[model samples]
Target: MIPARSGNIISTGSVCSYIGGGETHAYTCSKHAIVGLTKYAAVELGQFRIRVNCLSPYLLATPLANNFARLDHDGLENLANLNSNLKHVTLKAEDVANAALYLESDEGRHVSGHNLLIDGGFSIVYPSTCFSTQNKIENE
Candidate 1:
């Protein structure tokens, strides 16, 4: 189990965008590494039928962090905004557990080395509706 983790290590180490203190890419990079690790491990473990994968999840509704439950609505929303594009991508433990169940079952029998991003829509972003406007602004 490549433990789904935060990008603290990579974010703190060396990403061109992280000049000052960028926790965003840090955790992003961490999860990215998990994907790479899962792939490499799965390739080696294919002979053994030992599947390897990652369960990359965003901010979940758990008591892992200190004073998280105490946060107000906006604060919570702000946290959800980080790393994910989903407005209110709140994840419950059951959601993750259900995914795990599917992965472990025969449904995922052949699936391996997947960086299953359980983030509501955080990892996947579509083209912006105001792309031209933003491009004009940048050019100006």
Candidate 2:
């Protein structure tokens, strides 16, 4: 890509990259590393017109996620939706792909070293605590 003078390097990350999600220490560390790499590489490679970015998505009901969460597809989806700040919207692989497409396309030419979060605002909002408190209030 250095020779080409234009390139886009996109890496996969997780919400764990920005916040703890009860994931394994190694997994969280690796995700964090990906963000660091994206930032550093973007700085170093920008002169060559190479863009480096990351896509951090929340939990999806993939086989690996299902196995890790020990839940079936529907169960995992339910759990994710229940905890998501954006209710009624289930994340899909295609959503991540679309983000990748955007980053790679000319539309994102000016975007570099960006960690595009596809987490449905899950990383920004503490749904677990907020929802629990809401439930308590409703019950009361």
Candidate 3:
């Protein structure tokens, strides 16, 4: 609260901020906007002892995501596994929540203007073009 003069603001976003192409341009732009807002708010609110951060998670098998992708739970998980660089671990909703908890708690006191990714190294390692190119190469 403003009365407290200290607070934390956490926002959600997609991994599209780092790498986009599988979806529409507008969707990617909005995710990038969230990142920008986090940074801007961090600078603007730092004096008030308010921290602003964003948690960008990759595809998780949620109702909204499932509806958008038109895939079942197993299919969505399979797709995420195939596209992600870290294949051993699957991304769960709780994982994203844990990231939020960290930011909200004292553990992340010094963390601000950060876009903490909950992706399984997907944005860093998986190239947007690699999927299409790899399939083409295999076919050839």
RMSD of each: 9.7, 5.4, 3.7
Residue 126 in candidate 1 has what lDDT? 26
Comparing 1 with 3 on TM-score, the higher-scoring candidate is 3
Q: Across residues 1-140, which tens digit of lDDT does each residue of candidate 1 receive?
A: 23442111111111211121223445546645666667887787666666776676555544442253356655554665554566655666687778777777878878777766666664355223211333555677
Model 3 Cα lDDT, one tens digit per residue, 70-140:
79998888889888889879999999999999999998999999999888888788857322334555677
Residue range 6-67, candidate 2, lDDT tens digits: 99999999887887643667887899999999999999999999999999988888999898
* Cα misplacement distance, residue 61 of candidate 1 (Å): 2.4
Ten-residue stretch with the least lDDT total in model 1:
6-15
Scored by CA lDDT, what does every candidate get? 0.52, 0.86, 0.84
Residue 93's lDDT in candidate 1: 63
On lDDT, the leading prediction is 2
Q: Model 1, which residues run further than 4 Å from truth?
A: 1-26, 66-89, 126-140
Clashing residue pairs for model 1: 7-26, 7-27, 11-26
| lDDT (Cα, 0-100) at 57 in candidate 1 | 58
Candidate 3 lDDT at 103 equals 97
**Candidate 3: Cα lDDT at 51:** 95
